[model samples]
Target chain A: MGDLNTVVQSIINLPPAVILALGALLIPALPKRLRSPWFILLPVLALTFLWFLPVIQLSDYCIVAWNYADYSIMPYVSDNLSRLFSTAFLVVLITGGLFSWHNTDSGEKIATLFYASGAVGVVLAGDYLTLFIFWEVMAIASTWLIWGCGDVESGDVGMRYLLYHVLGGGLLLAGILVEVMNTGSIQLQSFAGLSGSDLLSNPGVLLILLGVAVNAAFPPFHTWLSDAYPKASITGAVFMSALTTKSAIYVLIRLFPGMDILVWIGLIMAIYGTIFALMSNDFRQILSYSILAQLGYMVTAIGVGSEMALNGATAHAFSHILYKSLLFMTGGALLYSVGTNRLSDLGATLKEATDQDPKFASQSRWLFGFYMIGALSISGLPLLNGFISKPMIIEAIGEAHYEIAMLILIAASIGTFLHTGLKIPYYTWFTRDSRSGSKPLKQSLNSKASFGEIPVNMNLGMGIGATLCLVFGIAPVIVYDLLPYNVIYEPFRAYPIAESLLTLSGAFFIFIWMKSRLLTPGVLRDLDTPLRATLPWIRQVFVDFPWAIFEKAEEIVLAFTRMVIKTVRNPLAWLQPYSSEEESTSTHSTEAFTPAIEIVIGLILFTSLVLGLFLIF
Target chain B: MINASNSERMNQSSFFTRLPLWIAILAAAVGLTLEFTLLRGYASHWWNHVPAFYLLYGALAAIALLGLSIWGSKVLNRQEAAGTNEKEA
Candidate 1:
């Protein structure tokens, strides 16, 4: 039994992230038929490795620790919190792969697998350094996903996305660097709620919050979500939606809970995203804004800072990933069947049609049923995952006596249904404004006529997602047990059910009452108005930046050349040309190079000062 | 002329249009009845657990958003033609 325990511990100690990452590297070389199965297999292997470890204290149970001379790093740590998120991430990886099975681009597959693995990497990281490494990996790999959506505009958008995240990464690294210098140890689990004085005293914590908040889409830093997500590939968006923001939320809940300002930031995001999403025309853009809104709930829960609220945040993250992926999968399927994502143009079912090859008739596509399940679940309808989890946070906030915050959150729930549940589906599948209503439309990704059915794998991905949503909802404890904290909150109670039903009814009423207004298909302006308005200037910064560098370098070289020419032509030019003395001091080499030395000295001092602070404080 | 497909989908999605009306009425009736039930909590603030509080709040929130959105689009939004010119620049 002792030997068996040792063996189990050794096997489980390997970080699932490393396994998935290595698996990603090997994917491009795999046989064509084997690649699809490999996608599902790798994440499953990682999950299995996470699950079967000997029960022990969190520090001892299946930990991978490395001691390098003076520095020690624990790269892999398994606890309930890590395992719960890892499980959700791996399942989404499998389903996302399934949905995009027909996309033959190996680069897309490899980048996506790496992106998913990076998310697991963050969850399993036991120290700040390990967390930073995974955080960067997720940022870079997800950028590739946006670019892989395949167009020149997507390329530029991916670059913009990369630059913003890089700024966030810089702040995070600065914080971690200062923290390690101050504390001289790398412990990063279970931070207690800090008082305002503690926060004021520490600059490191504030830097970390700013870094994480960018990814969480906290108000002013949020436009990146709306800008990039709508342009991502159908399957890629599914993966992107599940990981980046939620992982940031996980880090925040783990580290910075109970910050009073988080409540207001979250409420603003919830209402703000909801309103814009209601006004947006594209279904995917609507979903993108919905990400901001959904994240607001999780952020607010983290801010509320009770065991029940933390549990709600955890459970809600798990359920949101599943349903949001389902919603994206529905979009992917629709985009595959029809040629566009415009809600006004996208209505009509499959009709019988044979392609150029007489034997090839497209199969029957029934995505609406699965789509409705996702829509209703997101709206927090009764007997769905969002219902089971979202209410817990609201109840916690209300119980904690933030009655106004709770009211706003409930109102935002109405906005959630207004956009995601009603507007998107109502415009996409149920509208009668199609240009040629009776004829079968052609598919874009594949050159087949819209006829028989959606791809089986796509439907399977959505079905699995919808099933999990229903299961977590009906028997809510499955999610509750997996949360990092223990809390007793029941969802089947009357008050919550009453509120959820009423919110849905209210959203329904608003949608109808403003039906004509919302029926007009056009884009709403984002709060990040400057980003779009000055896009040309933003592009010119990048476009003009390299030439500016070259021009500066040219000036420096020309100055050096002129100095050399003068020295060769007239070595005594440093002497006064019209001085009373016929000759100046013969060798004043030191005085001649004073300005150059000053410039070099200034640069060196600035670099050392910045680096020295990290070393000292 | 409306196609068969359009009418069928309308029938299918009639729930979006009709269910709200029915559920709004039902929520009003049942929420009022719940005021007498043991499940209702103490009203710490003025608006706490008002009968059909969700309905009143959600409807008012929606209307407020609509009014604000109309004003924003008119005042804050640039023309689509302007967007094209910017992209070209």
Candidate 2:
């Protein structure tokens, strides 16, 4: 043990995020064939490095804290809490790379590596600055991943995704600045309830939690995930399912454990994700909502904040990354096979998979098998990972005396089943009608692109994920021993397993009986409506004001739009229609564009808006 | 339960055509039986081991959420075309 500690301490501790990010940078410049192999290799190397790291505790030097003037920024930590999550992050990255190996281009793979690294970086961060830097990297990298999907729709969704994250990043930066100013310490620890950087009294800490909530996909702040994730490329969505939100859950566990408000927030999220998941039209969209519901369990566990609850939260995150990524990979396979991602398109692909020669049968048969592993595991069925981890959280929270919260989570699992476990598979793989909102196989599948057999790499990616779900379910200790908390909770005990099984049983009867009512694909809207549709309508206020006021109002709106434009170029970019033809025409015109006068007006509006927002928020 | 040809019957048994729901049903029955007879299940909180606690609580909570989600879907659910580009508006 002493020698091991010495080895861990002596080695140069580079943050795994940096290694992956630098590796990603080199990939785009590499030859095409070299790029595909690097996608799998980089994450494998990072995981190996992360696996070799020993458990770190209370030691400043070994934790990789760097000093910049008065600020102590620790970019890497090797505590069990971070190690547990980092292990999962690398696992999904490897799987996602394999899933994408044959399908995606170098740019998409590069963004995925960076996104994974950002998540790994945030998990290991020991200070707020370190956390914030990686948090911003995640914001940009994930947006790039979405943008690389190569569709105008994805580009539009990518911009919305970027805007939400940038706002989240802005909030986090504001919180960090205030925290440093008021407390004079940069350590990444939770504020007290009402004193010593108390979130209750301290607006800064509250802001920081809100910032994390956006990434965690807490209800009302969660529309971006469902809106953008489904639009990303096959592999992009797979990489996405593993990171961002899970990293947010890690930060929440670290920073806001035992805060009672999280219990309520979590319940809302659990119910919210469960319900909304059932309403989506696409496979990935439902899974995206399922991700929200699942994160609710983790968030709720963090709120319970006992050692057992934290352990359950972390363990659940570790398991969820694999299953969810597999779910997305299956969705990607279906999407690649059938062209469109809508649930109605499954019949077109299923016919191409089955009902064909024996050769094609092996592919869809295994594809269905892999998809079910993810679905059953997510549903918390017996002898699967969800059974192992989901009930552990409920038992822990119940032990912590949050009975109502515990019961709500138990109930929410049914919702998880309704969508992810039941609806997604039934509709995506089982529904065999190429009618009404669905196109037939002949129309959808051309000779060039086929869904005959999922590529070996995609199958391997999903197969590994499914295998892990089964492995961890059969042997809970593989996860338990690695938990930050000492293990006492056992998932295989009779009563908890009985309770989970019966609950799934009872809810399933309702599913079979109420199948038609529940199966319809409907879009679920949230608080973001006011920001998207209502905001532009309200922009007409500038049109009706006094001429003098109108000019100034346009400047103010322009100033704010410009700020938003700096971070997000679309959505608002459409407000200014600048084509090359227009630019050329304007160049030939006598009208001169003035910069100084506009700058003065922008400055005044910018200052006032900031003052107003500061006073209001 | 009438007999079909061997090859005809063999064709009906593919694992691909159906599996998850059956496994769910199988697990549920097994769990229900174990809880009823041999296995004495434990609960972290009070009243968890009472007769049919899992069935009742889980059912109630699921129903409540389902009801709430249905109501929410009325307000929250949008048309398929709702995702059209915002720039047009």
- Evaluate every candidate with DockQ and list the scores: 0.21, 0.27
Candidate 2 per-residue lDDT, tens place, A1-617, comes to: 99986676645355678889989999868888888788888878887677765345348323676689998877877778898898899988887877777854776777788888899999988888889989998989999978876668888889899988998999888988888899899988764243223566888888888899899988788999888888877778888888999999999888888887888888898887887787666688889989999999998888888888889899899889988998998888877755656665664456544554344455666777898899989988768888778888988888888888877888789888878877766665555653335223465453465445568888888889899999988888898999988878778777777777888877776666666555444456766777789655555665445566878989999999898876465444333434344577686343534343456678889999999999999
Q: List the residue pairs that clash in candidate 1.
A: A362-A452, A363-A452, A363-A453, A364-A452, A364-A453, A365-A452, A365-A453, A365-A454
RMSD to native, candidate 2: 13.5
Which residue pairs come into collision in candidate 2?
A495-B41, A523-B78
- What lDDT is obtained when candidate 1 is compared to the true structure? 0.75
Highest-scoring model, DockQ: 2
Please list the residue runs of candidate 1 whose C-alpha ends up more than 4 Å from where it truly belongs after superposition: A1-9, A53-62, A189-191, A195-200, A348-365, A434-453, A538-617, B1-49, B74-89
Compared with the true structure, what per-residue lDDT tens digits does model 1 show for residues A197-229? 576578888778889888888988888888888
Model 2 iRMS: 7.9
